[model samples]
Target: MTSPITTLTLDGLETVYDRLAQAIDRAGEDKRALFLVKLALLNAQALGDAELFQQQMEKALLNL
Candidate 1:
């Protein structure tokens, strides 16, 4: 069975956004894409649901 996704609080989201921005900066322009792909793959593996990950990816693509 698929587990319900946990929603992050506003404060938690802000913290994560800040950390992600910092990490992207550290990854540098030359390798930021690679860094993000690696991060996404790791997160997807942890999530343990490829279908859910694909759905999330689709949601993320909206309004971008």
Candidate 2:
């Protein structure tokens, strides 16, 4: 019983993860870590996982 928007968001997240992985491979470890943090946040928001979202935000801040 997933909505169209939800389905689209999941697909978008997959695409974003793929692109981020490629970018990380081309760049450096730090950049890859940052992208991963971002991906986690986006995933949390999309799935209404507030605890994960906050944890990811904290991790991202620590990285910065």
Candidate 3:
């Protein structure tokens, strides 16, 4: 037997992320950037997508 597959969609997350990134940039703290990325990854884990967690972590670090 085969199991079912589940998909995840985060509508409007990009826009929110962009705005938050802008704020982080303004704050100008490397540690803050790291923690924000950690927070995002933790949320991703709650959503059950480890791959997305990693991707978001990297993406969060991009501007830093």
Candidate 4:
């Protein structure tokens, strides 16, 4: 079965965006990539759906 799409409200999105930016800054220039990979892996594990994660990865790659 496909996972349901979840949408964050504007406030929630802003909160998340702010926190993520803070986290990346805290990770510093050298460790930022590693930190992001670790974060993505942890989130994917929590999500428990490989196909959904793959789809999300594809979406994230768009226009970049």
Q: Pick the candidate with the highest lDDT.
A: 1
Model 4, span 1-64: residue lDDT tens: 5456688999999999999999999999999999999999999987889988999999999999
Residue 11, candidate 1: Cα error in Å is 0.2
lDDT of 4: 0.94
**Per-residue accuracy of model 3 over 1-64 as CA lDDT, tens digit each:** 2234455356576777788788777667867867676766676657676675677669867979
lDDT of 4 at 56: 95
RMSD of each: 1.4, 7.8, 6.1, 2.0
Clashes of 3: 0
TM-scores, one per candidate? 0.92, 0.39, 0.36, 0.89
lDDT of each: 0.96, 0.69, 0.68, 0.94
User: Candidate 2 on 1-64: residue-level lDDT in tens?
Assistant: 3323333488898997798678779767767777766766677767676765587578868946
- Candidate 1, residue 44: lDDT: 94
Q: How far is candidate 4 from the true structure (C-alpha RMSD, Å)?
A: 2.0
Clashing pairs in 4: none
Query: What local lDDT does model 4 show for residue 46?
Result: 77
In model 4, the Cα lDDT at residue 43 comes to 90
